[model samples]
Target chain A: MIGTLVQTPLYQWHVDHGARMVEFAGYSMPIVYTSIVAEHTATRTAATFFDISHMGRLRFDGPDAARFVDHLVTRRTADMPAGRVRYALVTNEEGGVLDDVLVYHLRDGAHASYRLLVVNASNHDKIARWVDVHRRRFDGQVEVSDLTNSWSMLAVQGPNAAELLASLVDCDLASLHYYTAAETRIAGKGGVISRTGYTGEDGFELIVGANAVVDVAKSLMEAGKNLGIVPAGLGCRDTLRLEAGMPLYGHELAEEINPLQAGLEFAVALDKPEFIGRDALVAASERTDVPVRVGVELSGRRIPREGAEVFLPAGASPIGGVTSGTFSPTLQRPIAMAYIDRSHAEVGTELTIDVRGRHEPASVVALPFYRRPSGRESTS
Target chain B: MKPEDLLYATTHEWVHVAADESGGKVATVGISAFAVESLTDLVFIELPEVGRQVKAGESFGEIESVKAVSDVYSPVDGEVIEVNEVLRDDLERLSQDPYEAGWVAKIRMSDEAALAELMDHTAYQKQCADEAH
Candidate 1:
């Protein structure tokens, strides 16, 4: 069974460093190197590196690149400058989210148009097929290719990410604004560096050739030894993103859950002339009876896991269910995101979570359970 | 108590049987050190209430970490007479002292035959090794 799972370029590095491997999205990825709590603390306080090569990388080029991208994503891409990155969603005809992706427009001087889209590893094959089927309209005017196999990606995140990664790459990372990327050289190899990360902390994600990613990662880890950079796994990645209140594809945004109901209206450009799901999303936005996503914090240490029903004290019927829940290492409490009735989604609204037949007292709170002191960006 | 002296169950619960003040058999139960390590970063543990009758191999309580929830099975057919209330808030005790201070429950045994089916220290160690591989 292990032979069937995909392995990243750093698979041997993770194994040699005592990582506990687990199957994730058909890949044998590191679930934890030591413990989830320790790695989560390191990412919040200092610096940490995560091997994210399993994420899909798709490239779009040719004359109709910008037009083709604007049609697929919900964000407007016509005015996106070179070295700019924007968060967008790809929705189906039913206005259900197909995937949430990062669109990068890094057109060099030589190329007239170039765009890259980073999609979730679990939805990689699905989105690729979706794009392939939709591109028949543009035929010879556009070219789409899968860069996931040829390129490896790594995320270096924390408060010290700018200073730590500066030693490995040949550019000043401090000047890189949030939600922007630049083409750079890492350890003499060409690559692209983006100032974006899933964690709430300040960080950068680098994409380089698959063959040289191992060397680049080793050099960065060696250089960051004094900075206390630890190799984090996907275990902490989920906790970190949950604490930041960012949505996971399967948990928060599913094929049946629309982006409007998930509180991602900022990523959707409804005014765009035409898109795959613009009409359905416009209708879904007017309906107020649909369940909306809200943050819930338990007064006790008991965690409200996925599918745990949410209810009021006077009612026996369930109002909603938890999408994602975890013990936040930063907040030191159990926090969860749930989709509840719009009437009860206000902050400070009292609710009870049925955690495995036990009623736990919880309250609606703000979106993010934890926020950094500074360097916060509102892109996502 | 040393691990070698305690009886083990395949579900990872450790049992120590002794005669109480009334000369009736009472079994002190807790999870093994291996079980505590496997359930890392324990956040919550639901302790079974006292005076509840439980069957052998039946789940009596639940233990949860950030990412997983596991049931703590009763290793013997008994009436639960006492429970560790401290473990409900202080989960670190389970990791620090899984055998002695981390004891989960105390049961008054109605069937002594269930004790004979449990494994000893050496056999339990072999079982853990086999499962690890």
Candidate 2:
């Protein structure tokens, strides 16, 4: 019998490369290699590669596919231009988050109408089953295939990421705007490259077919060696994203939280006719007492990790708990994201985070804590 | 690493025993270099307040790394006399020189007999080896 756990193609490579292994998202992923700070700095200054094959990828096709998926998601799939990508949260019927996914519309004059939905690895089977169960509701024309087992993914991130990738691929990387994606070849193998990332860095997420992923990743690593490209693990990935105030699944988004409360209001298309969670989200927006997702910078070096209590402004009782925290290399301090009372979510509001036992002071701050302007300006 | 003249704990704690100016036995305890290497990049430390009572084999405080949190157990039953407060800001001292600047706490042993129960240098090293395998 097969083990319940799965390892990516580069599992042995990670062990060989001195990765500190840990289980995350159901895969034995590298949480760190040597030091998280080193890998984080590499991504910000130059480039770093990641094994994100654990994340699930499913393909949808057929004539009425676009229209069918439009009903399935809050975003209007029919409106998505070919060779583009958009971030959307898949919600359950009760308005709870099913998963936050990036949809790739690959209708670049191809005869087939196909869209690739990339989802969190932990919720792969759950999302696949959910989509299958709801397939008939999508106007009975769209066919869904769980390509999760047949695909591997990599994300090369850094300010210099585009330069390295563009040098390797003949495609004009400068034309690609943030949130846009395209189907291209790397070393003569085809894959989808998207200009989106978990870390707030300029990067490309290359989705390779199962067979080609390993070779593509190896080539990218070799090509980026002089660029200080390190093989980053999930530990640095978490710290880097948290520094940029990105919400992680299960930490910031969960089955109990809707997009509105999680501060993902822009992703929810309220103007769209009807979708899952529309009614509940409408009612949810009316509630003034709903909690909000906010960022906090710890005063001291002591980091307030997940489950640590977050005391609100002054002597008031703790209104929330830390969802994720770490010593960010860029910010050079302990940064965290937590869900707290809307009253206490205002930027610059002082609070205390009880890190283990001591009350470490913190302050609420605006999100996307680090932003690097794209070399290519958005024409939109 | 700080060399504790007293017997050591198999959990990697070095205990130094000395007769106080009074008749009571005083034990200064801290983690060994091997333990510090096992836990890299210390982020924060929670040490027991001075004058707090602790039993032998009981946790006096904890040190947190990016990876895990490990409790520092008292080697002998006693009252906390002093704590390494300076190490709070500079936790690398534990990995740098666990024996001296990394001393976790000093305690006045309530029962001097507790020292007899701990392992000596050679035995503690063997225990550390056995546990790892």
Candidate 3:
């Protein structure tokens, strides 16, 4: 018999609200609250909350904390200012991505600076073990701890997210620039709020104590009930991220896929003097035959699902394969991301996706099939 | 509405037997409500042409949701006589009234004995409940 899946602090809330639960990353999570399209549109127009507690959170504390983090990730985190966050990838020595993570550089104490890392849930154990084995290369001053179980994470995202959250959070939301974090209290509970999101909207991610998160979520929902805030689920989360041109770990980044090929060159700082996967990424960057990820817009209504073969116009052989795809609720068309030969990764390149057995015509388009318009200035 | 007079397929399609203008029996086919609910957020569908022949247990059309795709199978061997082309654009009908207005196709039965393989309303309801667990 299979083992019981872990439940988030908001598990009962989701079920009470008529969410359809599914197993994801060893946890029972909500897949959809209502219709996927409805929830997706609500997030784009107003605000939506997602229970992201299943993601792993790690804390590093010590005199060499900054140095240890700089060695672990691909980005230059040692120089990152306090209260700032950067998206980075943890790669193996061979330049293959193990997981894409968000590194948060919080305030420094007298003896040590603190850094927090948020990683994918499915790779939580693997990443924890990877860090344990690699921290041996650093000085004994650094200490690493897994805080995944102690923290409950929730992301409130959309155009009206700031206004909705400002009513409940004690800190000033206006000063929190994009990709910045601050310690604050919400609904009388201590927490960390960051101006970051995956939905391509101006939003905030609130990390609170696992025991106190339910009250925070309830307060935010009550405050935003009139502002069209709805509780979103994993289904719309997948669609929203896809529309933003974000790459998921399992779908776009894998052990055999390097950062350059995944179009994540921005996250990799090759100028860093020393780091894991730097050499392999440098060599891979000079090579021209690597398959590059590109976005495709179908000429018809047929959705090109993951693992669908992409072929050249009138050609019988496969040229690439789709990584993630969905019927875009915002664009009202079928959009997908695929890894095709570098020669065929140009904008407007004509291609056909073998959706099941039928070949459907499509064209290479720019990444991010949709971008939300920036909202009004924060009300402080 | 659930139709007690219609025969149901194990694949969750309902069939209504009727007489054509020439007094020959024709089977009107549509997917059941359970099938529509399971395939949430219907996006697109491809139906068989009016003159195409279909065999029992063979796929005659396809439907897709945002995350999944499913085949609509024929319950009895016959030639397609008519199709509800309107469902191509208005997919909500599939879930709103799956038995009547959402009927996918009308086929002129080639073998009337094939209806013996289908289940009744009560039997199909029990099967759905059993599969739920």
Candidate 4:
């Protein structure tokens, strides 16, 4: 029998707003509020709110906090300025990704320095144990604590998200650069607001106390109601991120999949002197036969779902399988991300996807099937 | 559309049987409104050819949503007579009017015995409620 699922602080609020609930990562989360396409379009054009409290929040402090964080993830955290957030991967000893996390370096805390790591909810327990095991090897003073239950995260995303949220928060949303965070107040509640998002749009992620999350969410929704703000769910979240070509933890990165093959070379700091999974990633990078992740756009309306085989033109053997697939609301077409033979991972490479026994025509395209007009500038 | 006039398959497909001008029994088939809502975001559909033969309980077509793909099982053994080709271009019809304009296909029944085994509207409603729990 399945264990009881957890509910976020906004669970009742979502139900009252006509959200369709679904079980995801041990949490009873909303999959859609009204319609997936409507919510997805709202996030792209106006503003949308997502209850992301299911994510794990870990806080580290002490003199050795910076050093310990650098050793844990693939990104170079030692030089990360305060109020900055970096997307990084935590890999196992064998170089496989444990989880993709956002490492935020807070400006001030009770300790000498503090670093917060926001991780995937499903991998929370596994990552907590992983951090504990690695902390034993560190020589300096460091303390780690799991703050997942104490905090709730909400993602306010879209082109107008920053402006809409600025009215509700006490921070200077205009001055806040993308990927930078600030300790601020939302609806009179203390929280951390970061100008970061996964929807390939300019947005902010607000992390507030569990008790104050509902009030903050309600306040933001009320303020943005006139601006076409909709409460989004896990369904549109997947499609938005997929349209942006972001790799999900289980879909693109897994216990057996490393960051190198997933086209996340920038996150891995190869120049670092020592780190977990460094050697394994170095070895895997030199291999020619490694399957690389690539985006595929079907020539027709049929979606190439996860685990669907990808085959070379007229070739009998399967080269790879789709990891994540969706009908992009922005593009209004079916797109997918797949791990195909590196030789066939180039843009415009013709291929076929075995969609329910039928080989549908497809072609390899560049990552991120959709990009906003002002999205050319890199946030991270 | 009233569910009382239609027969339902356990797979959630609805069948409307009527006599043509020549007195031959023809079955019009489509998925129920409940199934359409459950699937959500209809994106693509594949229907059987006009001349193809289908068996009761056998998959005759496919429907795809953003996150899932499902097969539309034939409710009674029959030879495909006509297909709702317009649905391939306008999938929203499947959810907007699943009972009338969204009917997937019409078939000339080869085996009438299968129709008796299908459920009525009330029985189907009870089955849906039981599955909800």
Best DockQ among the predictions, by candidate number: 4
lDDT of each: 0.90, 0.81, 0.90, 0.90
The model with the greater DockQ, 1 or 2, is 1
Tell how far residue A256 is off in model 4, in angstroms. Answer: 0.6
With candidate 1 superimposed using the best TM-score fit, by how many Å does residue A63's alpha carbon deviate from the native?
Answer: 1.4
iRMS, candidate 4, in Å: value is: 1.9
Quality of candidate 2 docking, DockQ: 0.31
The 10-residue segment of model 4 chain B with minimum total lDDT is B124-133
Q: Write the per-residue lDDT of candidate 4 for residues A1-380, one digit (tens) a residue.
A: 12378988898999899988888988999999878888889988898999999999999988889999899999898898888899999988889999999999996544345899999998999999999999998899899989899999999998778768877888787778888998888889988999888898878899999999989988998888888888999999999999999999889989899999999999999878777899888888888798999999986888888899999989999999999998877887889999989988889999999988889999999988988886532565
Q: What CAPRI class is candidate 2?
A: acceptable
Model 2, CA-based lDDT:
0.81
Ranking by lDDT: 1, 3, 4, 2
Model 1 clash pairs are: none
What are the per-residue Cα lDDT tens digits for candidate 2 across A49-70? 9989999998888877776566
Candidate 1 local lDDT, A1-380, one digit each (tens): 66899999999999988887888999999888888999999998889999999999999988888889889988897679888999999999889999999999986546566999999999999999999999986545789999999999999998878888887788777668889998888877889999999998889999999999999989888889999899999989999999998999999999898999999999999999988899999999899999999999987888989999999976799999999899988888899999999999999999999988889999999988878876453344
Cα RMSD of all models vs. native, in order, equals: 2.0, 3.4, 2.3, 1.6
* Most TM-score-accurate candidate: 4
Expressed as tens digits, the lDDT of each residue in A1-380 for candidate 3 is 11388999999999998887888999999889888888899888899999999999999988888898889899999998888899999998999999999999886334235999999999999999999998986666789999899989999998888989887888898889889997778878888899998887778999999999899889989988988999999999999999999999999989899999999999999989878899998889899898999999996888999999999999889999999999999898899999999999999999999998999999999987887664543212
Q: What DockQ, between 0 and 1, does each candidate earn?
A: 0.60, 0.31, 0.59, 0.63
Model 2 CA deviation exceeding 4 Å by range: A1-4, A108-111, A313-316, A373-380, B1-28, B32-35, B48-52, B67-70, B79-86, B97-101, B112-133
Q: After superposition, how far is residue B38 of candidate 2 from its true place, in Å?
A: 4.5
How much is A360 displaced in model 3, in angstroms?
0.8
**Per-residue CA lDDT of candidate 1, range B43-124, in tens?**
8898888999998899999998877788999999989999999998788899999988899999999999899989999999
- lDDT for model 1, on a 0 to 1 scale? 0.90
